[model samples]
Target: CSNKSGNKILYLHFDSLIIFHSITTISKVSVTAGKSVSIPCLYDSRYMNYVKYLCEGYYWNYCNYVVKTNKPDRSGKYSISDDKNQKIFTVTINQLTNKNTDYWCVVEINGGSDHGESFQLSVSSGKNSGGMKWCRLGRNCVTKSSGSIDGTTVTIHTTELNVFTVTMSGLKPEDSGWYWYIQIPVHLTVTEKLINSKYCKRS
Candidate 1:
């Protein structure tokens, strides 16, 4: 988590009560297909039984498990879990598709209350895409003199976002290479378009 101007950017999870003693922000995330991603959350207690806290909510939906109706809506796609004593709730999803779906995690606190957060799932619509690509200001993809490259490797601990903004400058002929990446285990969606030539120049 990074702090800018005394504001802490943290990802909220679906494990705890809706109301909190302190103001906590849930950082958005992107995930890929056929992988398990952890939806981030926080709580004020040391106990990890957040599934109990969810009982306060009016609705609880999980992988083929609906608390209210006992009937499956969409089977085998979601589930809930705990992580040590961190009060973090882990939501596991499997067999991702290209369907632009929005997942909702609703909760309640102070007895008979409710609140929610949502995450988006996006699939790659084009071929030959870049992963978390970096770009500079006023530069083409092949021009090394115009932009800088962050390369293809992603350091998970470096940035606290499922969404990354890529920017570069002075992209010269030598600057042609694969610049970005999207990790499936992290639930990420990447958007890429051609800035110059179809192929990167290796001057």
Candidate 2:
């Protein structure tokens, strides 16, 4: 097992069969609706000559290519650039909207396995940003304008400039993982609270 650029890899073996699974860190990026955001993707030096591209979709295998180092998007909504010397590529998404969801940074390989890292994108309305939704990846979402989910409450008012908060009451160990507020994604971890035995009274 190893961690690379926020991606966690694990290997499972069943007899002679081996399975590889990866869990990527879903970063939260707050961008106003109709605004633009640039994301940087870093790859191994061995893939310097490989084709770098940006793909959009909730699933890795089904993601559609948005932009590539060789084929720049002509729609002007997406752009990509690569820096071979630094082993990094940058992709810019312009005029973002709620429709923009999950994305993957990928390196193409011929006759071999391709490498990719996935991230989630969240879009916030510049006006009336009070309404927000909380969601787990590939699952249903709870909206502040409607109701809460599993004791999770979202603050209907903006706490600060372009900032909102969500409180998940009675968090359990299973609640820890990737979640999103509208288009913004965050990784949450829940651990058991330890109490000092010295404070306990004998029954």
Candidate 3:
């Protein structure tokens, strides 16, 4: 994962009972439809040799298997790979749709608790609409050149949530507003009607 913000490592904790088990990962992840996303699941060093997999679904009881490290890419859309050296395994999903909105990173353990962490996969609505901008300020984004913002990506921090980042390729001319860290919501207006043309006759 590229750290545009260079924040500290984020640790995800379970409930008080399982607080001992901590998983390192990003708080939130965002991807565009028809695009692919690579999510890094940093596990404890102890799980270096364990089998890793990505499960898909909103609920833990129904999280169906998408891909496993032991299994190669049979579907050509989902894949898993382990980097034992870094104690990290990555899950990549391609051709994501709105349905592909939730997933979990799982590690298999025989006759014991299988460690896992959940995350939300937001399919950007503006990604297809052509307004894209990366969140460089962590929780606050301000642009004064333009009075309004068009396309801005919002990512929820589900884990440690100390630092969250959303990346997009393009920036719109009008996407200038403040992304307040707190209760302030975004205010953007699409301006397809603002086009100026001299072809029409005056009434």
Model 2 lDDT-worst window of ten: 17-26
Model 2 residue 144 lDDT? 52
Winner by lDDT: 2
Per-model root-mean-square deviation over C-alphas: 16.0, 12.8, 15.4
Question: Candidate 2: where is the Cα deviation over 4 Å?
Answer: 1-26, 127-203
Clashes, model 3: 1
Which of 1 and 3 is ahead in TM-score?
Answer: 3
Better of 1 and 2 by TM-score: 2
| Arranged by TM-score, best first | 3, 2, 1
lDDT of 2: 0.68
Q: Number of the top candidate by TM-score?
A: 3
Model 1 weakest 10-residue run by lDDT: 63-72
lDDT over C-alpha atoms for residue 199 of model 2: 75
lDDT of 3 at 180: 30
TM-score of 3: 0.54
Ranking by lDDT: 2, 3, 1
lDDT of each: 0.37, 0.68, 0.59
User: Mind sharing the TM-score for model 1?
Assistant: 0.37
Which lDDT tens digits does candidate 1 get at residues 62-97? 311222112222565555554445444445556656
The per-prediction tally of clashing pairs is 35, 3, 1
lDDT of 3 by residue, 55-74 (tens): 88876566788888988679
